[model samples]
Target: MKTRKEKTGFRIPDLSRAAGPISSIVAIAVGLMIGFIILLISNPARALEGFAWIIGGGINSAKDLGNVLYYATPIIMTGLSVAFAFRTSLFNIGASGQFIVGALGAVLVGVKCTFLGSFQWVVGLLAAMVFGAVWALIPGLLKAYNNVNEVISCIMTNYIGMYLVNWIVKSTVYHQLTNRSLPVANEANIPKLGLDKLFPGSSINGGFIIAVLICIFAYILLNKTTFGFELKACGYNRFASRYAGISEKRSIIMAMVISGAMAGIGGGLLYLAGSGKYINVEDVLAPEGFTGISVALLGMSHPIGTLFAGLFIAYITVGGSYMQLAGFVPEIIDIITATVIYFAAFALIMRNLLQRFRLRKGGERT
Candidate 1:
């Protein structure tokens, strides 16, 4: 019989290594700890109250949670875009450019294609996806054939898309009084599916539902299909896959196109949410494009995980907004989120170490 000392390892084993949601959960918890520390530093007397406010959600209305869903809709799409490209080993940093072009397409359809009545919004969304795909295709092709760095090309396209969309809006749908694109026709609006009644004072609509379904669809496409397998194979090792007869260049282009489409769909869903979002001649990149990258990282680059990641990010954002009532600046929310991202990276490292330990222990046992 094994002695008591032999029953277990001399040192305690760290459980963080096992594959599961443990890492993500620990990352979030530690992130909150950091945020709490910040809160205490900023306002010692009101720190407890402010911290509660950050996590209390809404004290007065269901609309608070509803608004979180509203904000999450587009991010979920953008997150999926980033995650899909990441899985294919293509860093599509041009999601911003794709998102802008897609928004332009949706706006055009919203303003001119209202004649289609109830079918107008659907057509507008499809147009947006096509526009985004086309925009990303330039960088994809350049990377595939000319060996151009996609990151640089994507950055260039971001400016191009920004200026192009600005010009398009100015020349066509310019609303001079508002200094933005004109209001979309009601016919092009996404239906609320009675969510408005369920959560009053919120912009919640069917777009969130659509985003969820699309997330599932992307998961199936990436994990359960032969094409997905080939794409991943190309990503894992282009030379090996080429020897196996895979068209590496084609895979690269297709992966980017799909990524851009997802981002474009996000733009459409956001602007068509019946919330009166309009394109302005802002001198800034679409923030959602970058936010999606963070969401993808937080979700560990999995499409299904991205869905929940998007939702959680949105939830925290909403909670963060409430911090203002407790005398905190809105920017404090940004700090908290950044800290969360930082700790999440640390948690990933710990998880990797844990996995290595498990493998080594198995080897010793054998």
Candidate 2:
């Protein structure tokens, strides 16, 4: 046995050197096993088959892999959006709203404009990014100037945005308004990446390439840019950063704006890839934005990690839906995701325990 002080004195390196990877593996395994057990309780026969299908259907063909990547595109963007805000110590709970605004903006541009044939895509995407930034800036400015909590302000903005977009789509001049019924315009449609012709049934698009480039850009911005340093410093200590001549107000607003832009771009990618034209405002607020938070958390706020995290999530979502069709309830994926998040929350606690054990052994040897 060792004294309490001795047991608590282990080096940080000894505690976490191997624990990071180990914890991740453990977290994933435990989460999946728990999901399996839940499925077993719900329907054992389907459980096994569902598990098999999830693995087989998602990895059996090149096309399947393409679908996974397709789904991963938006997830990566949204994950970066959430991660960027986390670095600034801001919880942007309104990514959903910002995403909707971006979608609406993109659709409006895509439909109303007919400049260059190939250039229309760029214009629509740019419109989405700019509008999304402006939408998010409102909450950010309020937080910075009025001492409003971003979390609350963002949530309110989500509802307001939803209603406003719905009104615009249903009543504005852009409304289809045909003889009997109105439909979204054809020009506003995002063309498939020719994957439909090549693969025959895939929804993969150029958005995948854009997503990868954005991830690289985000990584560079966060790790290599002066703006990132200022944002991070403000997050760590606003007072200290201010004393150091960094403007907290500016950093906060800028951080949120960038975050909003990333999210907006994600929404544009989503719309351009599929989902046809903006059907309804309600359709815009899918759980992807909320799921982005999980991606950010699981990735530990690292850009590289976010890419993998997004892929993993996309795998489970697409694969999980297949599993549901096969027999097992799709909710199993939700259970697994929740379990993983729960375990992730305790990473610090586990590190402390491992440190204590290492210290005790070292003390005994001494």
Candidate 3:
């Protein structure tokens, strides 16, 4: 029977487990196609060259790869933040607020508490996590008890956090000349952990390792623990979880808190890179948080997938910068990123279509 089936035609592969990854790949391919079309319209003569750069430019040197890792670190944390909340059946738009608040807390410690010695950065990270958790807790509380929508509360908090940071920075750690927060203490910079030697002039640091470890930890927590199971159960059906004595309200609140803490740590990692970057007292919210949504969606809310998705975005960003050499402005990269994000939002639909196709194929074979 198997030989006869093979002689007739190739069998349709099982797509049940593979649907999510396959859809994500399709989304990426579509996004890239659209980006290439835009490039062709803008600069027909160099469109192919610019496209090549956008695809493989990040591998040109060790420094470029290192920079990709450096940039991926923070976004990975934020991606994990979004992914965690998503798994818990919650939307965490407040990641931006949590991130900025956490950054401020780290800065306050890094600047005012130099007496912490070599532990300044460590304390700063802890402060950032604490601040982020507290910031998220407000929305979690409102959502759990008052039946408030987290989206609205989160949006309000983003503006509040941005303005609050601006005001506080000017009062406490303001640098009059630069109009930004003061530089962190020398010891407050995250350790390079020999990444400087490995990357040769790249800003990569131990923070990348931290980000990777967190990803692994998150994967394990979500896949191997009873608590993780309960959180997911609540997400799938809160009333059912409650009937099972899972305390859905507690799970909801904890999920948001954990998500916020991750976002906060991301802010701390970015600012403490010791790369001479300082927090600007700007009116805009942190972009990393919003980008996290793209990463989570693209990764299908899988922790490991989110890590790779973050790296892919960073790789594309680095490649886009090189597009200038190919007669294309770097802003084209933004168009590409936006397009990818737009397509990523359709991953679920793609998955469903694939599953339906698989079912039809199975029925025919039977």
Candidate 4:
């Protein structure tokens, strides 16, 4: 909760604030324990090797680590989107919709606008934020004024965005025979920022840097500003916040809009990064958005914590892809992830237990 601390960079500063990180670590450990049980049943012989990879795959090489960063980039944004809205007691479930719309905005700009060098990505990214904000605005307005349930509106908007963007791609920028949007313009592609040299031909790009900066920004916004104070007050109790003269409606709307804009920028950063992946006519929701929910939960909706959670999730995904080496189905990774989510519920329990034990130990020492 924003009430937990004031402006203080990344440090937790106490055991009380350490609960979130401790819970996340517990979740990971429990998830891995479940994974081991599954592996024991499936293939006891190769289980150890597979588990080893799951834990250490990201560091196998520079390329592997780069892949982790590439995967983390979008989710980091999406995670922040979810976290930011949550701080204001709003659920921005439309991040998927915002993400797709943002992707569409970037694609449109990439195809139509021509900017010099890296600035193209800048323009496209801004367009994405605008598109995403616009897409989320109606839902925010409905939640603010009409008292509509934000989750329902957000879900409906998500599907609408997905279908609408798919249609636009098919009609405007569909790559012939590829079934995907056309490649972004050369200028629109995200700069390597010298990472290409380090990873030596990986998907790593400037997006990672942007994601980190944004996470820090989110931290600052939530902890250091008067505006953030109002949002958090609203989140803690809208009735009390309203009584205190904080306009709950305006805070809710602004929170949703900001959350959506973050998601949109994430989509732009990802597609514009020159990854082979592109938006297509698929009816499927953007996986990155949903994955962000898990990341937010794992991080307990903390910006700095989300960074580690995103990276951890991305790391496991890369490691999971290599499960075939141990003669296991790669889908096992999904099972592990699901189990992790399931285990995430226990994080609070673990935290409570830790708290009790710590108190008891203190009492004894006293």
Best by lDDT: 3
TM-score per model over all chains: 0.92, 0.87, 0.92, 0.93
Report the C-alpha lDDT of model 1 over 14-130, residue by residue, as the tens digit. 453353366777778877788888888989888887788777764346999889899999999898998999999888888888998898899899998878999989998998999
Candidate 2 residue pairs in clash (backbone atoms < 3 Å): none
Q: How do the residues 319-351 of candidate 3 rate in per-residue lDDT, one tens digit apiece?
A: 998988998888888788778778877765776
Q: List the residue pairs that clash in candidate 4.
A: none
Top-TM-score candidate index = 4
Sorted on TM-score, highest at the top, how do the candidates line up? 4, 3, 1, 2
Worst 10 contiguous positions by lDDT, candidate 3: 1-10
Model 4 C-alpha lDDT per residue in residues 64-105, reported as the tens digit of each score: 999999999999899989989887888888899999999899
Report RMSD (Å) for each prediction in the order shown: 6.0, 4.6, 5.8, 3.9
Those runs of model 4 whose alpha carbons end farther than 4 Å from true positions after fitting are 1-15, 115-118
Global lDDT of each candidate: 0.86, 0.77, 0.88, 0.86
Tens digits of per-residue lDDT for model 2, 81-195: 8888987899988887888777777766666676646677787788889978988999899988998999999888887877777777666524354311123244545566576
Reference-based TM-score, model 4: 0.93
Candidate 3 versus the native: TM-score?
0.92
